[model samples]
Target: MVFSNNDEGLINKKLPKELLLRIFSFLDIVTLCRCAQISKAWNILALDGSNWQRIDLFNFQTDVEGRVVENISKRCGGFLRKLSLRGCIGVGDSSLKTFAQNCRNIEHLNLNGCTKITDSTCYSLSRFCSKLKHLDLTSCVSITNSSLKGISEGCRHLEYLNLSWCDQITKDGVEALVRGCRGLRALLLRGCTQLEDEALKHIQNYCHELVSLNLQSCSRVTDDGVVQLCRGCPRLQALCLSGCGSLTDASLTALALNCPRLQILEAARCSHLTDAGFTLLARNCHDLEKMDLEECILITDRTLTQLSIHCPKLQALVSQLLVVDLPLRDERCPATLPHYRRNLLSGRVSSIILGFRGLLVGLTWEVENLRVTVFVFGCEPNTGTQVLTQIHGQPVE
Candidate 1:
């Protein structure tokens, strides 16, 4: 046990190179690449082909609003495996084509919000990157259905696809895509308004491996489409229908009953949703972790309380009712009620209440079952001075 400092240094040098490479995997692509500039030995290790299996160019902060693809291509040529360029708005069609041509080995590619990309870029990507398994084109507004045909022909191994907000794509494009990419595990089409029930029907017939589907803001999709999707994709683990106005309780009920493994649901703006829909959700989808029902006016306190009781793992719940409410009271109410209400008022509530009416008579009332504080205001008389009153209710406002 009398090891010297020199012996310890020699033992450290004897460490396996595979162990050093494993440690490099945890470091971000930028930091790992930066290590290359430290010393010759570090540069050789960092620039090794195996070390470039997953490359993220999103860290290029200099001139962030400008194209960085050329710099990326020059720095990590032909070695990228997983590339994510989310929010890189400066990347145009040419830059994307260049990146695709060079990084043909990429398996996971996320280009979300890269607005400058168009249909031609997809064609270029298809021509080069044939090994792509995961592709996220969310919010790429300029991309059209023609790109789907190219992607289907090029990337045969694509397993996960996200085309959310690509409004230019219609049922024809989606049908072609589903038919071509049979192994797709996750498909996200949120905000794709042009996609109707026909697309889901096609998907049901084809992509059986789909485990997650996000149809948020797809206004044209009705319960009929979701029924078909649930019946086909039996292993679906998560579904997001936030802002899908056409979906009713029937669709959600069917999904809850059939898709037993469904865990996360986002039905934030489904205006037609009622307590019955939520009840079905609580009973069937017992493993649900997060649910967003923010603007669903029909969601009373009963539904929320039931959700809390049944879904014990529920971590985040967003509801507009939990924020603020307004209450109107009669002028004949006793002054004693106002004293109790005044004590409950907060500075944020006072500012909003003052803008409504000049005066208000405080009163307490129950809406559903949750407690809420309300503000009351009234217009002024001949003197042009308004009156104000604040009220707190034991139930939801």
Candidate 2:
């Protein structure tokens, strides 16, 4: 393994440029920058555009300036396919305009948390980057419908878009987006409170290929909108209705009747849902894997029993409750007692939660193939809240 001076100098001189680039490819941005300062030949190998195809500057987001991005874009040019500038708050439209012009072949771009960017960036991207597939503009609050319009006019190949926390978005913007990006498979619209029934209607009309739709906190949408959406977008597999207070059992019934392939249903804080709605959902959506029923006060033991009986694929059920009665319980056990209380105290369970609030406690355990997690909340305790979790009968921390 010992290298003599002749052997050491000969290896670098004899190695092919392709092999040197291959070795440089394994180095990260900081190391490559250091390598560029070693010597002239190392500088050429380090700065070669082919070795900088996919760069993630998230670790140095605070230090990454506009000039750094511009230089990287110029260096990589058409060879760059993915670039993530997530949390780079200093990045603005001018730098991204240069980036779009240079990196025309880029497919996946993560601009999440880039608060300084605006519609101009989207305009630049649409004008150049037609191969764009996944774009995350999460929390880019400054851009409004103009950005959506720009994206709709171009970027027809977009598949996954996350506009979470973009409060300026309205129905018109959503309509324009769905009309153009008809192939959208996953769209996250969380906290876009301006969106109403019309936005969902637009999604139902054009985005039939949608598999995951997160409409969390879009409280303006009603059951009628959800019904129409469910009927139109039957390919939906994961849906989030959390904080959509206007939704009722009618929405659940619509999902059960039309979206049978539903796998993940996050209905947390949807207070109107009752056992009757969940019973119907369980019977039809047999492939259901995870369900979040937290804060759903109306659902009782009947809903749990129905799910345990019908939805065999159910893996996780999150609810806030003091009691549950599943059909799998022995008939000899008292009906007044919860189905898992005996096993929970006997240490036969795989997992356990000892505390949540003094008034109500949540115990989660895995039995055979079923994994249930119940989370309950009550008034703040005088002694403060403490959570102790145990896995395989051993306390964790």
TM-score per model over all chains:
0.71, 0.83
As a whole number from 0 to 100, the lDDT of residue 380 in candidate 1 is 29
lDDT of 1: 0.72
lDDT of 2 by residue, 90-156 (tens): 8999999999999999999999999999999999999999999999999999979989988987999
lDDT of 1 at 132: 90
- Stretches off by above 4 angstroms in model 1 are 1-46, 61-71, 74-78, 320-397
What TM-score would you give candidate 2 relative to the actual structure? 0.83
User: What lDDT tens digits, residue by residue, belong to model 1 across residues 263-375?
Assistant: 77888788888888888878787677667776777766567556655765655555544323233233343464444443333222211212212433232233343233443
Candidate 1, residue 116: how far the Cα is off, in Å? 1.9
Q: Candidate 2 local accuracy as lDDT?
A: 0.82
Count of backbone collisions in candidate 1: 8
